[model samples]
Target chain A: MGDALLEVKDLVVEFKTRRGALRAVDGVSFALKPGEVLGLVGESGAGKSLTGAAVIGLLEPPGHIAAGSVTLGGERIDTLPREAMRKVRGKRIGMVFQDPLTSLNPLYTVGEQLTETIRTHLPVNQAEARQRAIDLLNDVGIPAASRRLDSYPHEFSGGMRQRVVIALALAAEPEVVIADEPTTALDVSVQAQIISVLKNLCTEKGTAVILVTHDMGVIAETADRVAVMYAGRIVEIGPVRDVIKQPVHPYTMGLMGSIPDPQGGAERLVQIPGAMPRLNAIPVGCAFNPRCQMAIDRCRVERPTMRRIGATDVACHVAGPAETTP
Target chain B: MLAFLIRRVFQAVIVMLTVAFISFSLFRFVGDPISTMVGQDATIADRQAMARELGLDQPFIVQFWRFIAKAVQGEFGISYRVGRPVMDLIQERLPATLELAFCAAIFALVFGIFFGVYTALRRDSWLTKVVMTVSLIGVSLPTFLIGIGLIYLFSVELKWLPSFGRGETVKIGGWTTGFLTESGLKSLILPTITLGLFQMTLIMRLVRSEMLEVLRTDYIKFARARGLSDRAVHFGHALKNTLIPVITIMGIKLGALVAFAIITETVFQWPGVGFLFISSVQSVDVPMMASYLLLVALFFVIVNLTVDLAYFAVDPRLRISAVATRG
Candidate 1:
């Protein structure tokens, strides 16, 4: 990217357990450009969500960033003190969690939540904040925004509540938004609507977004660039279309193969054999070596670093032209 | 809201009637009121004449109906032990008992919530451990023993306060209050603490566990993520949710404080309804005992009703549901 808005370098997150220190996110790094939508796609426990939480300085206790440098607008943020970092979150970088139903405080109305957030970061009076909250709700496509301001979370349906959560996140007009599985908790019918609403609002504001999700289809629909993670490391990262059409990493290829092709007349979808290794029992060299069909002796002996191929960067020892682009 | 109130009131009426029936049967079967009324020297003819005069010779159903009617009108007849109207006696002692209970409830609620939130926030601190240990003792110790212990310390040993009685009370209109005057206020401390200790500990434990649970909820995490100050997140978001269950417990415990203040009252010899109740029991005063039971049951009904109404104030979900049903 010509000018990156946010940069995460050599980020490593570890949890202190009774057994010992267990690394959850191992040396993950990526750059997000201004106004660009960067999708982080991975299976569960793949550290996609953890990485997002780390960037915002919100890793729960016992789980901390062991070693990392996160920069926003060319200024280092990972090392900022707690109070200073709090100002950065929801002001410089907003967050949208997985479940909208639980994301909102049930005791407060949507208006109060939105306005309180707005007033927390911005230098505005209550009346002005209230007006801004109404505007934000309207921007997220909630009808009668002013009238619905007094309604509690339970009064709204799942989709409407999500819209309110998005409005609250965008109330401060943050430079970047980290949405972690925003649509996963919604209905299939409303999932697309929520994604479109999120996409349209961020796009309109020229706000950069880090969309963390496990759905490759969602990434295709919303992300400008995509990073595919496996076992807490990025297996491949590139332009969404390029990575989807020509995945070089074996893990990414297997992932793309597993998704059902709606147009193609295949009765059964391709499935990757075996399961991802647990954090405690990950193989020393290539974490995917045991399950990768093209694993060689070298692949078993040493982990591969990212090597650029075409428009994508992949981390696989056996990545070569032998496996044709599907 | 009106419908909810109406339903609650209806339920309260049923409860009161059930309690009334139980107390009625207790007075009817527990002792012979005529023998106590006439004294031991009265002949059989005198006893029969006295029974007829009091309508005790009527059918059981008719007598019970008359008792219920008189009770509704606040007439519980005369106390056999004191030779006074039971209602008048209760009314005279009512202020002392209410004042004692009210003070105890306030102490328990304020300190319990404060200590609860403090301990929950600083769970790993040494101070929290000490508070929890002390609260455990407060919970485990019996009420009368706690009262006696306080009296021995503050009254007998230190000689700082009076050991027994409501000292130098002031009468304001119909209510005789010990709230004013230095000695009267000093007299209340031991009894209040002794009565409040168990409820305070119970509320503290409840609030602490609830606060811990609320802190782990997703809404709390989301609030933190939204960059709300730690104070705002903890108190504004988490504490409000924690209080929903605490309110119910506090309401029920407050009612229990009033009904069961008999032990603390007897220990301190505070002139309250519970003391009267204890004395009436010793003398086998059926009218006083029955009326006391009815009064306690009535107090519980009012407390439970207030708690239900308070839920509507604290939680918006209930209010919305009520509106939805109405619409």
Candidate 2:
């Protein structure tokens, strides 16, 4: 509401598959405020990762932004050319990807890689860059950063390498950081440590973060707000505690119930029936109609618009707070 | 690292001994050298005396061992064709062949890698297509044909270079200044071009394919995502990653350059090891042939060893894996 750092509206991405034009991200919208963390949660093929990629202008070939407005720091980015977009990608918005082992160059030493990134966007000399690289490595909890800087990527364990990747992302000191499945490749213990580091660093620097992940536990731990995506559209969005305690959308409720609690006795995990529809074969009315337990005849005949539900927004036909129900 | 060197040297010695044994046995297969050198018109007594004098009447195994013993002492007897020490003949011609092969390799490697990288960076462009087409033509054509065609263009039509011979020499205190002199370099031009062009085409294609594969890696993507310029991403990151295959091909190509030098020397009549080898074979000069084979084999082994060492310098991962294996 108050000068969001990033505002994405009516974003739609499509791929030209052999069957048809498959809409991967259909009319997805979200915003990130300064110093805020927004969690985007969905299963594989839910288009959550695609939405993140579109914001960073890193969508692979055959998939492209069809209709959208991505405004970063009040500047329209979706319309910018490639060369200009490249400048904004690393200089203004940093990115961390999945699979740290493959993300880092194996031929270069860790220090060389970090220094290269520092020197790329900053006006710094070699010695300054090297020192900054060591400092960043130390800041990320890598022991003896000075001595370990000379080690190559292959020398580090998987968790340590992910830490290095995070260090690289933070080197540019961008206004926003987009992390896509950042901890999916790490162990549970390492995941907690990485999440803490990311949250603390972003809060310290006042950088907005768009954390794309499937693990709801990560959202519970870090995100200020949660956006639930299904079949390429965000179906539910609200404050993290509100969304977790009382999800209005049946799909969101089903997801929250699926996570097994350590305190709970032996109870059957609630699972939403039916698979996500294929992109080229989406249903006519609501995309989630087949899986919705409270779906009425209107839900099967017409798609629902996003309506307000007690300081929350949800795209559902039959369920919402009374004030905004239509 | 020192231990690796010592092991390589020991292996090289074994390889040399094997080559010497095989060459000695193979040379004998062409029939008795003395009988071949001396005509059938010679009298029976003359033949007997000649066989005894040349030690041909001894057992084959004893003669082979004797040959080896003399070879070890650097006494590769006298060449029947040149009537000089086989070592002396080889030493005289070795420089010319080495010079030609060295120049060709340098020319091929520098230009091949450059063109390969350029084409890969500009993939699907007109320049890349033209370069690839030209390289295909160069690779398909035989070196001899290319040599002949170049001589025709440069020596006959253009009159820019001499057709044959080492040309005039200028000696300065036992060192030759004429190697880089105009006339000397002119004589070398055609053969160097012939050898370089063929290998360059091969190496360029190899480098291009390797570069394309390296560019597709996630590390290269990370480099691009780090805001690296295209030059840094292509040359610094992608090219370095592709060098292992390039270095391996370069080593094998260098060894092949020496082999190609033999044929090139024959075609150009530039007085190199290939010319000496051909005449030695024609006159059945066993010691000279044996010496040449051993030297060439030794050169191949050394080139491969140097390449193996270079791999460690280029990629630290190789060094780490090597050390881990040793431990």
Candidate 3:
């Protein structure tokens, strides 16, 4: 019970489809303490990105939070009005998107874009904002900060643009940062650089971060704690090392085994077979039962509740006591 | 950038030459201007002498060369019907046509973009629906019908404005203030509105669509995510992206404006190049027709060139590529 910077309890998000109302994120609960990084790992359509969007109050139309309580820095933000939520969005909870190239405007110079954010959140004049923009560019590792400030987003490389995006998120010195697959668009070599920059900056500022990524390697390298989601529900939550080295939930184990290790010799990587069910046609029982290798008879008739097993939390009837790490 | 400009200038010259040659050939196809102007009842000797005097009997290539040479030297010859210098006739009427087109274009750009942005921002709202419906009608209705409709409403019904003609003369230096005043503007109002209404609708639709598309870009969403205000996202980010296509259409529309002006001027009996052009065409005045056609063609080329250059200013990517090519 360290002081939680953000706490999402019993969060449920639903979308009204042509068929009927479909729950995308159901009763998901998570908390982030100051200076903590919570990696939300899930397959596509697992509602990880939707969760991030809900946290920031940007869940687009048709998909909305049906039931939830989101407390940020001691304030209940879930029920806050639109104007109030907007004030908290960039000033308190910043967001970095998946595609860095499309996440920056082509018309504006990078400096102009950055300065606009600073000016909006801060009580600063144009000259001060401009100076802050130059400082941010320098902080983000862009060369010739002053000169590059005038350069457009297209002028920068993919990784550099991601850095600029991070710079924008950190411009107002927000309390939390939600980076949704920030490195997914960059090359593998550049991913590490961006992750390191983000980690170092968050650490220095004691800002909580919610990193939504599907890459397990990114989670192991950057996250303090990880939440593995399957079909829009968190199947497992624990310390990064514990979850990766010894996963409790069957789905988590399948995810960990799916990754091919470069150091290890040729081994058939275990993959969770079958596609995720569409949002409109979810199974009646546990969402992962169809894909779970160790699913029992009860797993097909009832959804599992998240129960504590030693140091980890798992939502599976078959999840017994935690196994000792090898 | 300089290379682009040079290439554009060369293209413009080719366009002008094509216009000159086509209009010249087309006017001749209708028959010799001298014979047509003099009438069919004239004696064969009189017609032959008239043809020879006017250089109409020369070889087609030689006639084209002579026409081009005279045109370049500002000697457009005399109007066969008016019996006055074609240049003098055009000079007198050119200002009025240019002024009408300029004013209409300005009105269209200002109101069209403003309405477009407003509707896009308020998409699916009642205001947007009304604007879109109006735009559809404006685009579908022919310019003549709109002009006639406006004349009937403003002139025949309201009687608040003049129905035809340029109206009473005002002092040259005081023209700006005089023309924009209640009465001065009243005279030009019907034609300007008729021209601007259709163009404004077209421009508005273009801007609205382009802005809507630009607004959906991830960067605009990111801008909102960064806590930038709605104004910043819509105007600063979205609007800037929309302007490129809008400008491109506007350039092409300017050429259309000149062509439309011909019909508008005739309907209103306004003293403009369009009215002069219509009369020249009716009376078989070849030099007047050629000069007017050449000017309109030149207008399109220059406007398009300006638009091409504007692309460099709006997006640095173009400027960079342009520079790269030059280097």
Give the whole-model CA lDDT for all candidates, comma-separated.
0.91, 0.86, 0.87
Distance from true location, Cα of A12 in model 3, Å: 2.0
Residue B308 in candidate 2, Cα distance off native in Å: 1.4
Candidate 3 lDDT over A1-326, as tens digits, reads: 54888999989999988877889999899999998999999999999999999999988778899998899978899899887888887899999999999998888888888888898899999999999988888877888999999898888999999999999999999999999999999999999999999999999888889999999999999999999998789999989998998888988888888899898789899888988888777787788888877888999999899899877899988878765322
Indicate the residue-level lDDT of B190 in model 2: 82
**Top-scoring candidate (lDDT):** 1
Error of 3 at B259 (Å): 1.5
Error of 1 at A194 (Å): 1.2
Proportion of true inter-chain contacts also present in candidate 1: 0.59
lDDT of 1 by residue, B106-217 (tens): 9999999999999999999999999999999999999988988988888889999898999999999889999898989998998899999999999999999999999988
- What RMSD does model 3 have? 2.1
Clashing pairs in 2: none
> How many backbone clashes are present in model 2?
0
Tens-digit lDDT track of model 2 for A81-145: 87888787677888888889899988899999999889888999999999999998988889999
Error of 3 at B37 (Å): 2.4
The DockQ score of candidate 1 comes to: 0.72
TM-score of 3: 0.96
Off by over 4 Å in 1: A321-326, B33-42, B49-55
Candidate 2 residues B73-162, lDDT tens each? 878777766678988888777778888888899989988999899898888799899999999989999988998888899899999988
Interface RMSD for each of the candidates = 0.8, 1.2, 0.9
Q: What 10-residue stretch in candidate 3 chain B is worst by lDDT? A: B169-178
Candidate order by lDDT, decreasing, is: 1, 3, 2
